[model samples]
Target: MISSPDDLLRLAPDAKSLEAGRRLFYSRRWRLVGGDGQWLWGEWVYGSGQRATESAVHLTAGHFVCNCRARERPCAHGLALVLMLKNDQERISVGQPPSWVRSVQYQADRQAKPKPLKDAEAADERQGERLALMGAGVEELELRLLDFARRGIADTLAQGPEPFLAAATHLADAKLPGPAGLLRRLARLGRDGTEADIARTLGDLYLFVRAWKNRRTLPPDRHAELLQFAGVNIRKEELLARPGLEDHWLVLGTAEGQEDRLRFRRTWLRGEKSRRFALVLDYAFGEMPFERSWPLAASFQGKAYYYPGSYPQRALLPSTTPGGRPYDGLVGYPSFVELRANYQKALAVNPWLYAYPVYLSAVTPTLASGQAGLADANGEVLPLHPEYDNFFSLLAISGGGTLAVFAEFDGYRLLPLSVVTEFGLVKG
Candidate 1:
């Protein structure tokens, strides 16, 4: 028989581990109906009104597995079952993970890869389209930006050390219409540009793009700090040392666009517990921002490392979609039928699914399926799972809250959308 509750508590004193287990337990309580030693199993009711059986697995390694949608190392249901087992020492027959678990796991592993999501490509395409929309003369410049973007993307996909320098050099001193025009011109530089030139241009470009996209979402100081990355390298360690912003910062949304002669990425960050304070990490071709995001949020009571060093720890409310695009700003929300029709029309025109899944902030609120939605600092509605919901593109939503889509860049490195946006370059 199991000892007291304190015994179980003593077994896992690591606060982060305990918190993770607790969070997992509460997140999906449905699967854990009850257990018996011979064959620990329970029925999991789904939104579709279907009941699926999931076996409780207690492994020799002390690992737990529950057959559910979450692919975490120890899924929420599994943790719940473990907690139950720990307290109720009755020897129960916990069966192997069910067939569905194997099936779901197989599907997840099949789709897992280091490829950029569809939105990355969609962002590239959208940048092209946006440039074309800016003016007719910008076409030639757009072609150039596209070239640079291709190379930079390639470098990112391979996880190369620093590919931005090569891509950035191609854009220096190029002139075009607005910010997007500049990026298009830069892209035309090809491999002939210098590394130093690329770094400087990228540095400045990151700040501009990030500031524009997230102007409404961040507080004044954070906005200023992100904007500063355009001309300076804000060390990650420096940001970590600063005070009053440590918690799980959720990845809200990603946007890609281009400024003149530069490509950009903007990754939005919102604190799940702290609220109020938000961050935008802007990345450009040559310069890289320090990785201060983790320390900036997780430090509390002078003790750093508040978050666990495990998967599926940090997350926040999903993002809502932005209101109407440039000319469509005045249009009312599209009806479901209309939206579906438009989505279908989009597919017919561009039949191939996005190289990577395109993620959008929800234009409307929805809880169905795997989509996530939350309001941006500016109060804009961002959609979380448009690619999965509308395009039927296979994807894997990670426990770390990163949305992974498969697309290859010619040479560009994977950059956070916030970094790209900060530079006022094209956002993808």
Candidate 2:
């Protein structure tokens, strides 16, 4: 099955493409022309009169081929086709594949076949060139930061967003997308942001630049993190070579977000025996479905491969143990104090980490001091993030009583992800 609409939105190449696809869906421009058991076909008509171009989309074997001239893979026409199938499956009817659809499927199948490997020496040479380009980008970024400091942050802000945007674009062109993305976010800091927020953003950027420069001096684990933040791709082969840990991992909660063309699904897990936390990330591109999604509030015995880092959170599940049983109970910090201590410990290893899993054994939701928050047994309260929208639902579930809840702490506030209720786990 294809991903949900929210997932599709996240996988969209960019805001413009997503908006265009949404418009197509709303406008009913896509007609489900035909389908077989293995393939679905759609015809899309854009514009009116002579300006209209009839485009066709062929979906098969988790891939889409479209006759649109658009450079984007699974272009707007294809996305519209997917949306139509998802929303109006009854409109589609089974039929034989057209000649053009068969041709497209053949081409896709041929492309899917494995190709001969490239020479190791040539691959190494290409890698070296990439590293050199990234190094040059880092140096340019350092110079830009120096200039910003010399000119004063206030003055730089007064000049508007062009300078920062231009510098970020330069970094992106040089293949430093991680830093480029950070810079782009920094550039968009609005007037509503506090002075502390601006200062913290600048500090984080400065630290990242310094870490990239002095990476060699750091420990191996820290160095791995630095490389990751600098847009360096870690090969899956390398990660798989590391040792694996087998345990009963409880799925605490899940969250999803988008970064440009990529969609990220983060599943938080806790090892019942090891009492360790791990984050499993699944990514998709342009409406592609995630590899898999973990069942919430269930335990699965699996061998997890940990990425090399001081505080290893990201993991890969290569395989799962057969006949695994669900975990009967949840385990976590009993109070906000213990949760805060764990959060601080994680940050000591990875300063850039903004979110961590936290579980409160018993906390009652309350509206106090003009904010929604939870109060532990000791009467100490921790505020919830302002963006949390399930307060009333949580209140109703708990009946204003204390309940166990899994949440994400973003340095300042907690955002509830799920709560353990008599009925089962309710996700926020």
Query: lDDT: which candidate is best?
Result: 2
Model 2 pairs whose backbones collide: none
Tens digit of per-residue lDDT, candidate 1, span 1-428: 33433443444525555676666455443553444332234454556747553635423324244444442334444454566556544433444645544564465555554446975798678666643443332333345435545667445335432333333333222222234332433344324444544544444445345444555686654444333322223334444444433444434345445554344643444444544223243434323222222221122221122111111111222223322222111121222234345445544433221222222222223233554442222344334432223222211222222232211111121121221122322222
Worst lDDT window (10 residues) for model 1? 305-314
Residue 51's lDDT within candidate 2 is: 37
- Candidate 2 residue 368 Cα shift, in angstroms, is 4.0
Expressed as tens digits, the lDDT of each residue in 1-428 for candidate 2 is 43454444455556787677767767655554667766767666666723333344444334556645565655676566566667867767888877777887788776666545765678688888998898899889889888988987788788887887898899989888878877776677734444565567767778888887787799999988777777777767778898988888888899877867788888998887777778898877765556665778777888788888899888887777532665654665777788788788889999767668888889999998678998898898888876688898988988878999998897778889889887777796
Q: Model 1 misses residue 114 by how many Å?
A: 26
Cα RMSD, each candidate: 20.7, 8.8
TM-score of 1: 0.23
Query: Which whole-number lDDT from 0 to 100 does residue 68 have in model 1?
Result: 49
